[model samples]
Target chain A: MASTIAEKIFASHLRDTPTPGDAVLDIDVVMCHEITTPIAITDLMEKGMDRVFDPDKIKAVIDHVTPSKDSKTATQAKILRDWARRHNIKDFFDVGNNGVCHALFPEKGFIRPGYTVIMGDSHTCTHGAFGAFAAGIGTTDLEVGILKGVCAFKEPVTMRVDITGTLPVGVYAKDVILHIIKKITVNGATNKVMEFAGPIVDRMSMESRMTLCNMAIEAGGTCGICMPDRTTAEYLWPFIDDKYESVDDAVKDFKQWHSDPDAHYDSTITIDVSDLVPQATFGFKPDEVKDITDIEGENVDQIYIGSCTNGRIEDLRAAAKVLKGRKISRNVRGILSPATPSIFNQALEEGIIKIFMDAGFCVTNPTCGACLGMSTGVLAEGEVCASTTNRNFNGRMGKGGMVHLMSPLSAAAASIAGHITDPRKYLQ
Target chain B: MKQFGGPAIFLDRNDINTDEIIPAKYLTENSKTALKPFILEDLHLEGFDPQSDELKNAGVIVTRANFGCGSSREHAVWVFEVNDINVVIAESFARIFRQNMFNCGMLAVELPKEDIDIILSMGNVDIDIDVTNGVITAKGAGEKTFNFTLNDFARELIQAGGWLAYADKKY
Candidate 1:
């Protein structure tokens, strides 16, 4: 019987053949961060099950409200720190060393093809780009995963999305995903895996693929996966270097995880992006998107360029290309956070950091701040922001504040104009 | 099998996300009770005031599709649990939110759109959930009752009073 990648991974992990109802499958990685992991730790302690399945497989990081925002957030970090120490979890990343979990974990080569991963945060789906079965879970499931090295999931079903056309200039992966989300609405992929295939995805860089899969949850998808090819193998080559003779060997092994041509799908969608342009969200929901021309000139009080979704090194390069010498509008406050310390260091080495600062952008240490309104550049009441982060939900940045989700290139253009503007103008 | 239901607070909107159910700022609170007062604090539905007494006393919620659609935080369900709202009947629910509800020994009833239309028509009615029989009855004119189904695993989790108990027994 042929199977989709999701089904193949589930079958490999489960003790028996996978079925329709719930099945307990072994977990390969259990990711924990400060805010949500603390609650799970406290719960486990109360239940007297304060132990982990495998210390090495458990990666803990404090990135959400890092450097300790307040006593409350400080306490949350402290709990995670103590818990990591208790478990001898050497993979724990603390202040000055931590970045957003999604970006940091993948950068460290922690995720791989055909692995099963779970995290307490929704963006865990970002790892699905590696051809893994990754999903977000609640604290109860988190506790069970930590304790038993297992998680229960419904039988896997997949929705195949075929992108047939080349991405027009000025359109990034973020805009492509925003376009897909707009086409599907927010809940269209609910209860199913979204498998992105076809030429466009096949040509995307690993960074771009992560960006595409990161927003799978925004569309209510359990995961968004790309077939593991030579690009995927090269990205994971450094970590798996010892296991294979060459990248081609690794790709050959990964080909087994691909869905067979006759594999079943719940639904299939074909999107042609030959004429796609830069996109921006208009309202609270992510699906409320519009062509940049339709929403341009909407004045923004802030321009934020960072988050697990668009905080990687490539994202920085894209924004820097547009902001090299241009100063931001006086009315707009520009903030840029590279997703990881290594990315920050790379930007500094390449003079990208100087370009942003000279353009009046505030370059901060790696942290997932301001995206969720926890700290560092939060908007005031009634303020509007052009952001590279995911989710434009009302008050996502701060109470009564509005956010327009767009690509880093678009965000850079908006910073210069102090409004939602097209990045193509700056590219020219 | 157990029974849970009471006055239903209806919000006829789709994609009622976790951020609206409980804002992200409250996730740092030490206990689940700290989330109670802020339940639906950021929710922006017409004619629904966050400070309304009706919300405070309501024991159930009847809403449109995709209830709890954002964020993987379990706090969304905790807010409802702390406020004694043990059940939420909706057209459909996001996968993780529905599972979280069952993990906390609460119920998330998924009814079809047509049946949901009938229940939403009964304005401000009290509801009673018979978990064993998979039934929800609205105490209003016509006294209509709706049927919902739960998978055997969900029923087991509810009976065991959550995953921890179930794990204790099975693991």
Candidate 2:
């Protein structure tokens, strides 16, 4: 049968031969972070199911509200700390060693092609950039996954989104994804896998692909996937080096997870990015996107450039390129997080942190805090922000505060302009 | 089956996300019940007051499409469950929120747009849901009955008092 990559992965994980409807498939990785994992940890402990399927396959981090924002958050982290210690989970990452779980786990080569991963956090779909069937699940599913190493899902259906055409200068992967979400509306891909393909996806760096897939949930997609290829093999090569002779050999083996040319899709759509420009959101929803020109010059009180969505090295480089030898507008409070300690150290070593600090931006340790308004860089009432994070839901940054979602480059440019500004101007 | 229905709180907008449903600020709370008073506290829907008697007294929520759209936190569902809002009938729900509802032994009823329109037209009517029969009845003024669909797995979850119990029995 001609199967899409998502279907192939799902079928491969099932204990029995694939069935037509709801199938229980084994979970390869159960990623957890402090805020949500503690709830599951509490529940599992209460129910006498305080056991992990495999400690080696479990990865935990304390990225959200790190350094113990409050007593509650501190306790949450401590619970995860004790639980990981009790289980002898070697991959557990606490504050200083932690980054955002989505960015940190993949950086550690914890995810691979054809794996089925679940995490209580929604952005867990970020790992699907590696050609895995990764979905953000709820607490109950998280508990079941931790205990039994399996999860239930309906038979797979896919929507093939072929993003073709040349990406314009200053229009990065964040813009491309924002464009796609605006075209498809939020919930356009509900209950289905979003298969991102075409030349554009093929050319994207693995970081760019992760940025693209990270917001799959914003579009109500169960998972967003790119077929594993040379880029994927190269990104994972350091960890899988002994298993494969070379990157080419690893790429050849990954071909088993690719979709057949004739695979069935519930729907097919194509997005041409040739004329695309830098995009930013206008309202509470992720789909409320507008071209930068349409909303430029709206004064922004804050500018934040980080999150699992666009907080990697590439994102920092893009933002730094615009911020070099420039100062942020006096009215704007700029904040930058590098996603992980490794990315943080790399940014410092590359002088990116110096560029940001000199540009009057506050560089914080890697944490998912400010992105969700849990800590650091939270907005006051009636404030407006230009952010690189995913959701811009009303009060997402803070109650009565407005957030305009944009790319890292655009966010950095907005910090200079003190409002929403086009990043292409800086590039030129 | 755990049957439930109540006076419906009409949040007439779309894309009611988890953040608005429970807010990220309260995510650190120790227990789900601590989330009760804060349900829909951050949602800025027209004519919807989170603290109003209409909201506090609501047993069901009839909202527009793509409800519970952001953040996979089950706290959104827990907030509703803690508030005794056992049912949310909408045009559609974000995938994870729907599953989370069933995992909590709650009902997230997705009706067709036309059916939703009919229900909304009934004004502030109370509702009664029959889980086994999959029927929703509007009580008082615009008295009407509508059939909704719940997939087999979701029904089983609700029947088994959520995923944990189901796992205990099967796994």
Candidate 3:
């Protein structure tokens, strides 16, 4: 049978021919963050194994509760730092040095095409934008990877999602994904790998592709991956090591990282986004997304424009375009957090930060921040927010606080209007 | 590990995500004890406090589809373990949540929808798990037997007291 991208990647790491079942595969990279790493370390220590299998393959970052919100979290970060240093792990990124693990992993070039990556983070699938097969594992499974350098998996069936037609003006990649999730339902793709393809995907920027792959878990998918193309290669060129003769050479090297033309898939879903509108979630689940026009005048007390989902420079630029020269509603509080320090620096250089600051927005440091309800900008009881973060499960932002997920454009527009409003007018 | 029986608590809702199982606020604290009070606290199930005696005493939890759907936090599973919830029989489970259960040496069985409904109807009845035979038996009025599925790999991991113990023995 022709191999899907996931099958091709998994088979490359094993000596035996790949079958559609459980098998232990070697991992190219193992990533973890503050929230999950300490637990894995504790498990390793409890097992009386003090050393990691390979420090080189492990990437640890303090992102979730960075700057140490409280004494408890500070102690947890201390334990991770101590453990990484004791093991001489070279890829450890301390607070302020690293942003979110998912964004930083790609920004630092730790993820490459056709690699099998595992992390103790559900959004680990975000790395799949580079044409890699990545998925999240629990802390104990991460402990197993740390000790054995390999993790077991029950081969997931592939669900081919093909997007056609150019996205309409004012609609972003976030809308496309939210639309797909709404169609697929929250549990539609459970235990499956979603292989995104077609004309629209072929034309999407790297950041947009990352946005799509990042939320695959929201629909209960194990992972979502796109085959690497020239666009992917171009986005990765700058991050490639100096060993490559040129960007063209780097692209040439990634030629082997794609699914076969005849790759087999369990199911196929096709969506045309030519008439797509900006989408926003009206309820707790991402699948509750509706077109921006359908949700006009829904009031909100806050608006957030960042997270691993929509915190890229492109997302910032989109929100900046909407917020430029416009004052936000006095009744609303707005925050714009970049996904990584690199993106934050780029935004500053481009004056995106100036636009946000002049618009009465609180431009915070890059961290999971308010997305996980951990630190700064957490929602208060009875408050409603229009946000660009991925999950909107009840109390995701804070106790009794509600969130409506949307694209950065829509979120910024909502901040201006103090309600969930369409961004098309602002875009025009 | 063969036959074990305990009182079962039925949660009829579907898509009971990890956020509902254990919210992100409680995730900052690593202690299993600190997590007990918050287990299923977000569910707002009428007359059921996660800390109340009624829920604290139940050893098995029966629920509908997609139990533990969001976030890869093992704390969702840890909350159950700390609260003495040894087994969770759901119609389906999110992949990561299911694996976390096995990693903690807790049993997460996927039963047919009809069987889950039958199990729920037998409220407060003792449900016995037969790991070796892959059977679930309810010891109450109209005692019923239902078959469940467990791969050998997961069973072995549970037998060895979770992934940590299994890894120690392997590596």
What C-alpha lDDT do the candidate models reach, one value each? 0.92, 0.91, 0.86
Best by lDDT: 1
lDDT of 1 by residue, A1-428 (tens): 99999999998998422235777888999999998999999998987889998999999999999899789999999999999999999999999899999999998999999999999999899999999999999999999889988888888879999998889988999999999999999999998899999999999998999999999999999999999999999998999999999999999999999999999999999999999999999999999999999987998999999999999999999999999989999999999999999999999999999999999999888998999888887889999989999989888899999999999999999999888888898988
Clash statistics: count for each candidate: 0, 0, 0
Residue pairs with colliding backbones in model 1 are none
Runs off by more than 4 Å, candidate 3: A15-20, A241-244, B44-48
How well is each residue in A1-428 modelled by candidate 3, as lDDT tens digits? 67888888877875322233766778889997889888778767875877788999999999988789898899889989999999989999997788988888888888889988999889998998999989999988898888878777777589999999888888888999999999999899899999999998988898999999999999999898998878877777777757578777777777676777887889999999998988988887789888889879998999998899999999999999999999999989989888899999999999999999999999888899899898878999999989898988988899788899888998999999888888889877
Better by lDDT, candidate 3 or 2: 2
For all predictions, the C-alpha RMSD in Å is 1.1, 1.3, 1.8
TM-score of each: 0.99, 0.98, 0.97
Worst 10 residues of 2 chain A by lDDT: A14-23
CAPRI grade of model 2: medium
Q: Candidate 2 lDDT, tens digit per residue, B1-171? A: 666999987888888899998889899986898989898888877766788998889899998999998899999999888888999999999989988988788899988888888878878899999889899998767699999878778888888899778876776
Calculate each model's fnat, 2 decimals.
0.66, 0.73, 0.72
TM-score of model number 2? 0.98
User: Candidate 3 chain A, which ten residues in sequence have the lowest lDDT sum?
Assistant: A14-23
